[model samples]
Target: MTKKVCLILAVVLMSQASRACDDNKEEELAIQQSDEYFARAYGFTPETWNTLYHKPSSSLQDALDVSPYEGRTLFKRPQSSNNSFKKYFNRDQEDHENHGRFAFAGLGANIVNTGLFNNRYTPANTWRPLITLAKRIPISVNPNFNNPLGSFDPCNSNGGESGICTSGSVCSLFGGRPSGPCDQGQVCCINVINSCGSIVTLNNTYWQTPPTALRSPCTLTVRMDPKFIEQKNNPICQIRLDFVSFTTSQPTAGTCTDTFQVGGVSNEVPTICGDNRGQHMYLHVPLSSNNPTDVQLLFNFASGTTISRSWNIKIAMLPCGATYLAPIDCLQYFTSTRGRVSSFNWQDVAGARQLNNQNYNICFRTELISSQKATRMCMSVCSATDGDAFSITTPPAVLLVASANTGFASAVTTDAMEAAQNSAVGATYTDQSRANGITVATCLYDYLLIPGGRDANNVEADRYCGNKLNPSPGSVKFQNVCTNLFQQRVFISGTDTNVQVCTPIRPFKLTYQTDGQETAVDAVPATNTIQALADVSNTGFCLEFQEN
Candidate 1:
């Protein structure tokens, strides 16, 4: 019985092995078929190969264990190499690209008829240019479109109508007339929006223009708050009364203030008013008042024609009480020699202040028509020589400890002034401390007088101590160098003239000897050449005698 059983077991094992061999052959054929199908469709084998089979082993890994099932590994597919697989795929891609290039070249050559064409077969073309660019780019985009001004939403939705709203309007989805509007003489309009998030319209014009006669200047009252003045340098406000072309002076009772004479010749003229030439006028008012005040405006014109207009202005107060005060005395320098105030304005908010508390915040303006020259008076000072150079220098005070108890003694005037006014006002008070000398005149050149004598004919060149030479050809030319000394004591003798330095005196004063002279006029130093003296007046100097 045991022998019979062993024979049967051998036969069964042999049959099972044969069946396993047949199954392995079938799986190999299936893998080959799959590979053939993938190559025909996509030009490369499929990425993964899988088959389902039954195994007597308890786990899939046990069935796949190559150590136990050596020969049964079966139906081996070719393993792929990095280069070989890449080259195989790349060849198909190259073939597709070549097909496209061939088609493009065939079409282009047919159209243009140039020879040896790969693409774009024009006579001058060598190779096709490859195009490269992004179809879309990243950018910053503002997509909000609710407000026309492109600002925050113009809506106010507070519980109270007047609380957050500029005027007495509510932000209602059902837009209609607002209830409880502002009082009479005021209009409600929306000026700002609040957090509650609704549309708000407020009422009220900040200020209104009053009616006045044409061609005449009228004073308008303004209501200003003291808080406003605290915030501005000059608490003053400017306004425009009207535009006038001409004006005349009002006649004085007796001799109309005889035209302010030079040699006692009654030279008075009538004051006229009004012009249609369309010039602008300005008036200034102080806006520091807590209450409103009436502004008094004086109107004068050249012609009888009248003009009426209004001006608008904005006002704000400076941060500190210490405001920038313009030196009124310095303004005198800018006045025209012809004797009229030119139209100039200042908008430095840091320096404005209330005029007298009487003038309100109303815009101040006047008709600025160009006026004719005013007659000037001649004051004669006999035999007053004119060669002294005016000089000014400041030095930083040295600190000294006189007593152990006290800090530095109260600073001197120059020290105090410089400490108060630094470069904030653009004044070089500190730099003046390091300078050495005061002004001493080298040669006489009169800035106050008109051109005179032979010296006026001198040809000015870059001289060391003398003024920057201005080229004067005819009578203003200099035959020889007045003085070739190089020093810091040069004088500005005339408004349009320059400095002249020398050792020995010319035949006469450069004004009289070089330029030409009259009995009354001579060259005098008007300003310090070392300091900033560009803005000096020619008004106060006198003329002793007149010559033709």
Candidate 2:
């Protein structure tokens, strides 16, 4: 082929241009049917004609020697890619994410017999095979669906319309009309399912304060506004309380005896609401008041049948220095009003306080919700004495001392007690001092709970010895005695098996069975049975079984 024709062919092959943003390169080509480049050069580019005619073996040297346009063949095309077509196709993942690479020369040339024929070909004819291969096979490409004219996703205060793509189950924009927003009073709820299988319900709604449950009248008074009685029947507005009981696999004693005190001197009685029920229900306080004019509701959950209910109206606090004789016990009850007492003032014993002139209202709450149910006996509220005002003395401060010997020993003692309680055969508790670097001090006060007396005993045992066992005074006949001390009440038995002897724990009264099998006192029998022993000094004593 002539040099001019070779140059023209090279220019035409290089005319192909890649489109903007389009990786596939293809451009129109000028096919010269009568041009010397095609007519004289075997109707093909110089290299193609040379390769077809000579069929070179090695470095194209033999073809160059035989070719008339050897020197012009030196014009190079863009570097052909080394990666195979299959390799490029393999890069695609199932998720449609990939960076593919392709080689056209090897596969394209082999398919169409590219170098075997010499023809007057245009750029399209030269690259037609490669284009066909690419078009025939599908490409996994991501398509953009975003709309530039408007916001694609609609959202409401409620979490319903949240994600970009909607499942139709969720509210979303479909036709032309927009989806409505969330309603008032109710805030949006975020549905978050966490890894631990907990569904967290998040809401914008909030309350000024959390509601409190009233187990007793005292609890109701302490937690609620004294005037909260007005909201008695309001369903959503009313405070709700409940009681529940169930029989377990075995007839087990409850954690608490369900007993509470009334006046300072009276023995604590089992709450009525707890009768035949394992759990007790009472009042719920949604609001509370600070003014003295308000009257708080007192509900006694007596035996499941009888509920001793009353109203204790509070009197305003008086000036701190005000003088007056005590309100007499003879005038305790009020003459008029809804079976309510007239004007009455609670004394210091009823946890009363003298109002300070600077403070307009006196505020106090029940220590425990259960305390609100029972009425507290008050001291005489008397008018000021002519000469001097009476002053009640306060109890001294209690100081807890901690030393190396006591601190270390207390922990050891607690663990030992826990271990003994957990054993099949209760552990024999001896007050022997164990030395592990230091002597530990275990307060006997908490180890055992005394149920018989009015005062709760919290005395620590003498450091020298463990604890001494004392019996209940009520168990004895005739003779009157003050078994108010810790020794005379409840005592820690062998281990976890705590036994109430003569004076059985109030709410958990012993069902004495005369039948030999169900007797209160029994020897080591077979399975599923327990026994107790009673004495004048100590009632409800237990013999803990020892493991073999």
Q: Top model by TM-score, which number?
A: 1
Global local distance difference test of model 2: 0.20
User: Tens digit of lDDT per residue, candidate 1, span 437-495?
Assistant: 33322222222212222123343321111121222311211112222331111111212
lDDT score, residue 229, model 2? 15
State model 1's lDDT. Answer: 0.22
Displacement of the residue 365 alpha carbon in candidate 2, Å: 24
Instruction: Write model 2 residue lDDT over 201-270, tens digit each, in one string.
Output: 0111111111333244232121112221111111111111112221111111211222321121111122
lDDT over C-alpha atoms for residue 205 of model 2: 12
lDDT values of the candidates? Answer: 0.22, 0.20
RMSD of each: 39.4, 37.1
Task: Give candidate 1 regions above 4 Å deviation.
Answer: 1-215, 223-303, 306-548
Best by lDDT: 1
